[model samples]
Target: MLHVSDIHAYYGQSHVLQGVSLDVGKGEVVSLLGRNGSGKTTTLLTIMGYLSPAPGAITWDGQQIGGLPPYRISRMGLGFVPQERGIFPSLTVLENLTVAARRGLRGEWTLDRVLDLFPRLRERAANRGSQLSGGEQQMLSIGRALLLNPSLLILDEPSEGLAPLIVQEIIAILHEVRAGGLPILIVEQNIRAAFAVASRHYILSKGRVCFTGTTDELRDNEAALHQHLGV
Candidate 1:
């Protein structure tokens, strides 16, 4: 569904993402795992065109989208949930979803379906984004993205800072969301939860893809897991 090849990105000539590459297949959940500042978030931002890569390409369904604007890339079926959860603090839960609930190019994602995916969204429908719990805010963030009906959902650090139980619920919901038929691109620090839901995994180091393979492949290579992921 998505392809990123030999991509290189920079922030004011700092030169991050040196020849990074990976792919997300249709109806699959893929995880990108690495230590902090390994460039996982940058990779997703680049794919969504938030930061254009200096070299290489990001293609969706075979069309090159390397240099497009962020809005253009998003309109073309890319939905991103950043680590900060970018919710509108003043908007009510429903309003938050409504504000972002456009199907952009193709009309498939809807608020109703978003609530179906997250029952808590229905329960807190009237609360402002600031009034919701951290877990609720995360759900709202995910719901907001779902309303876009993206062909591929990119979630960066969805489990970060949440309690263990909430983390488990979020993981379950992510698995359920993927089961509902959309490809998922997850960048997570929670190795166990990430491995549970991801069909394949990639480990980044020094802003490059040092390892890429199925979950089982990663599981079997104990040394590789320790050296790259410390798992």
Candidate 2:
């Protein structure tokens, strides 16, 4: 569903991604694993056109979408839920979701569908962003993204700043989304959350891909996992 080929990104003269490449097939859930400063987040930004790739191509469903603006890329069926969980502080939970919503090819991630996936969101339907707890805000963010009905979902650190129970809830919701046939690229530092959802894994080092394989392979190869991820 998505292909990133030899992509390079930089902030001014500081190169962040060096010929990084990976692919996510339809209905696949892929996790990007590494310590801090591994360029995993940079890869997602480049694909979404939030950061320009100096070299290499990002193609979605056989069409080139590398340099397109973030808005345009989003309209082309990509949804992003960053670590901060962007939400309008003044808007009610429903209103915030309505603002980021869209209709996509699958026609699956409707408001009702998302509400079904996250019943707690329905409970806080009338609450404003500022009124929500951290976990509630995260749920709102995921629901907002789902309303877009994206073919591919990019989640950066979904587990960050949440309680363990909330992390499990988020993981469960992600699995539900994956079962509905959306590809996902999860950039997370938490191994438990990543392992719970991702069937495939990629270990990055200094802006380059060091390994890409099944979760089972990564688990079995203790040396390789230790060499890069320190797992």
Candidate 3:
């Protein structure tokens, strides 16, 4: 339910997302894969309006949101979980989710539902964020996002810095999330996790979309993966 067309963004004088375009249909999961400097994160930031796109368009459900403020975009049912996992270190797990709790179109996600999606969070409901492990923190991040009941979820590096088992758990959780029919736009370095939940993939190189296809197409085209993602 989101479309980005030829968007160009910049940080100071340095161009970041150059003519990058992609789309996420309703209930679809798409992953953006790229090397460290490929502007994947920048594209997300631009869509969320943290960085305005000067030369392109970003539309959600048909309305143009190219330069809207982040809060305004979020209010329109777009949720973003950045790579930093912006959980409040001092707040209890329940408190964190409660803080971002809001009603959306379906109102299908509640604190209890999110806690069910992450049972470990239920056990640590009263614990502070700093007391949790890396995996718990990641779960908390995604849980907090779900509390918003966003129509489209944008996640940056959800599988970064976690152990294999934890990554698998996160992937399973994402699979369940996908089953719930929420469209997702994710930027993940973990190829396995990205492929597990994403039906489609977009590979960026030097700030532009160099490749776009389904997971099976990506698997068959190993040369493109090696060229754009160095995988």
The numbered model that scores best in lDDT is 3
- Which whole-number lDDT from 0 to 100 does residue 121 have in model 3? 96
Q: What is the C-alpha RMSD of each candidate to the true structure, in Å?
A: 1.4, 1.5, 1.3
Q: How close is candidate 3 to the true structure, as a TM-score?
A: 0.97
- Model 3 lDDT, full chain set: 0.91
Candidate 3 C-alpha lDDT tens digits along 1-231:
799999998888898877999999999999999989899889999999999888899999999999999988988999889899999999999988888884333488888899999999999999999999999999999998888889999999999999999999999998898998889999987888889989999998999999999999999998997888778
After superposition, the stretches of candidate 3 with alpha carbons farther than 4 Å from their true spots are: 102-106
Name model 1 segments beyond 4 Å from true: 103-108
Look at candidate 3 and tell me the lDDT of residue 85: 95
Q: For model 1, what is the error of residue 204's alpha carbon versus the real structure, in angstroms, after optimal superposition?
A: 0.3
Candidate 2 — worst ten consecutive residues by lDDT sum? 100-109
Q: Over the full model, what C-alpha lDDT does candidate 2 score relative to the true structure?
A: 0.88
The TM-scores of all predictions, comma-separated, are: 0.95, 0.95, 0.97
Off by over 4 Å in 2: 102-106
Best by TM-score: 3
Clashing pairs in 1: none
lDDT tens digits by residue: candidate 1, 1-231: 799999999988688899999999989899999988989999998998888876798889999999999888888888889889999989999999988974444466677877887888899999999999999999999988888778889999899989999898899988888888889999988898788889899999879899888988988988778887777
Residue 58 in candidate 2, Cα distance off native in Å: 0.5
